[model samples]
Target: MNKISESGVIGVDVHTIKSWIDQDDVVLVDVRETSEYDKEHIPGAMLLPMSKFDAEIFPKVLGKKVVLHCAVGKRSESAGKMLIDEGYLETVHMIGGIEAWKASGFATEVQITPPPSPSELKNQEPQFLCPTPGEVLRDEYMTPLSISNAELAGCIGVTEKDIEQLTQGESKVDVVLSLRLARYFSTAADFWVHLQIERDLEEARHEIGHTIREEISPRATASN
Candidate 1:
């Protein structure tokens, strides 16, 4: 409970939050629903939904700054007040919560549990699945190269969202990104492009099998 002038709850912008994350000086609390948090959230935020917020954790976070955030900012503001009223000296909440963070071009991570081990994977039945290009970027490049999304984006002359989206599977890899990835990894551009094609085809096949069938007409060709 670091003290910061008994002034209700201080509001911080996304920039300040980024700095805090880089400097390792802040404890980010996602006071949103677990489901919401699971979809996407700040890279290092801890989920403590407003529904079951634990005042007892305040003591543990004492000495370090604590910041709370919800989908927008209202819930976090309320949660901040609760902390303040409960004697947690200083508290801050993101001015616009997760939405603002994303709008500001910051990186977000989907909260998926790690995949099973090779042994476990072998035990499971085989399925027609394609890995996201982002998964490849993360495991094959980012982790091996020890590079952050910001660093890669800066070097490759693209917005962080471009890299983040590709890695998170939210966006497909276009010609431009494929070239960039290939150039950065010293691989052929086709390698990256093919990854996207494979995933799209697999997903399309899966959806077709699960959904109702629709009739299709053959395309007419030009006559010589």
Candidate 2:
């Protein structure tokens, strides 16, 4: 049995694999079936199922750092070892595969729909006014109420850059600031909710604002 070194075989979790995909430095090859690949996969992963590995597909990926993944980790590990033996110097495997990626709070392309249109946001209110006491509002209404760093700055009257660190998830949530947000959004919700749902809120608010701007901006003259 040929033992691969710990460092030699990079055991990446799915989140790191996603980062690698974004960078375009590595190639993700799923050694699963065509049916499996079509169902859902990492955005840029090439499908070279292990069943067809002996064919022309496997030879082309040689001399590159090949990150192998399957539904679970079992098949990928086996494929990684084979690639290493076949003279591919760098072979990494995603330890927990796609399921691990989702569990780590990383977004997946599967089952996601396009965001709502501008008209949708403009008609919607940021606050969820209660019809009955303690009733939970729809996810659509509650989701937009969360403030982003940009909106948070707007709420408290601060510069965009002043809250840039906060947007990046680096800054600590200030309790005083949280209280201020609750007041600004006209609710007593947690500050971290703002940080968590900031991006969604920003897009929704911007779209609504854009719709208003378009409606108000004067139409251009036909003749100069």
Candidate 3:
């Protein structure tokens, strides 16, 4: 099968992707909406919907190549750009997505299982990086439930801007918001607060360690 290229994105045929799948040498990602992904997708593909695609939060391919796709090729192309922009050296988008794959006599996987119960979610660590509370809210809850900003605000009794700001990371997750999110998403309020605390600590460590290390260096004392 022939490979196509456009706008810095590499498009490979379904057959080529299938070869990688058989070899298990590539990380396949589905970049469609949650509802669409819950309908059907390529087997072994992890769902990372485009609406909440955070390059920093995305799982790395490690030693393998990364392949992305949606219902068609367009969204995957965009996802490819995001990955490339974020320093992914080897990335490919499935040309024509599952549609072309099925048309070419390849099989697709249908999602028949419901989401795990809250008890099941307990004790499981997040699969991606330490994401912000807003990112978790957007991807895990709001997107999955198809809740619009206005709808969520109405249900939770907050302004739409409040919800928007939280999701955009422009505002911090406070006790009230945490309570609302916890109630709506079936998670603990501390889950939301701890996500913010962890992110803050990570940032502080990066900057604080550099400054303190330079000031306290043994070489500085020796020179003095």
Candidate 4:
């Protein structure tokens, strides 16, 4: 009874076609001008231009559904009708064609999108400027207490260069320095060490935060 169906040519939407590409065994046949295809086309599509379209020799993958499409629906419908006329079991063509596919925000083989400029890239790439421990030292303790680099170095039992680099954000505060700073400031050692950890995390985030988010996801969130 299904073989006696009303129409052999089935019209499919771009979203459905896209799902077929992603989830099913399907072959996309593009019937368009060479110039048009050279500009932009669906990835992995077989080009069989309508200018020289021959339905008799139309490719049919053994276990795959052949989906025909053109720039607009007209030529593809005509092409599909040709296949039906050629004693084909069934024919499928994308309704609204590549025009609908582009309208639906699907990526094509050729990209006409302009690249961002240097200034635009700079604006797009985020800068995370969390307070470095050097900034904390200079702003919170050193400036308020009027502790000179030499004075702090002598008191903390560190070289003047070490204190200078630490205050200038070029060096990191480790356990020894954190303990010394904590004892001198009468604060918990965790305070300085935590600041260093926070600074390290901020730096790491600035460098590869986006890549990490793209590559790794929580298992629950990934399933969703």
Candidate 1 per-residue lDDT, tens place, 1-224, comes to 12222237788888988888899998898877666777787888898866666555654565667888876665576567667767875678887677788888998997667899999987866343245677667754577558999999998889998888888878888888888876775544555676677667767776684453455555789899
Candidate 1 structure lDDT: 0.72
Better of 1 and 2 by lDDT: 1
Model 4 alpha-carbon drift over 4 Å, by segment:
1-8, 111-224
Top TM-score: which candidate number? 3
Between candidates 1 and 3, the lDDT winner = 3
TM-score of each: 0.46, 0.42, 0.49, 0.46
List candidate 2 stretches off by more than 4 Å: 1-8, 55-57, 60-64, 111-224
Clashes of each: 2, 0, 0, 0
User: Which candidate, 3 or 4, would have the higher TM-score against the true structure?
Assistant: 3
Candidate 1 C-alpha error for residue 126, in Å: 31
Ranking by lDDT: 4, 3, 1, 2
Q: Which ten residues in a row have the lowest lDDT in candidate 2?
A: 129-138
Question: What lDDT does each candidate get?
Answer: 0.72, 0.55, 0.74, 0.74
Q: Write the per-residue lDDT of candidate 2 for residues 1-224, one digit (tens) a residue.
A: 12243324556777667777777767888775565676567777788765555422375654445688765554465466556666765677887666576677766555444766899877866531111110111111123345455665786776666566544444434556555544653433442343333434444555586887777877888996
- Deviating ranges (above 4 Å) for candidate 1: 1-7, 111-224
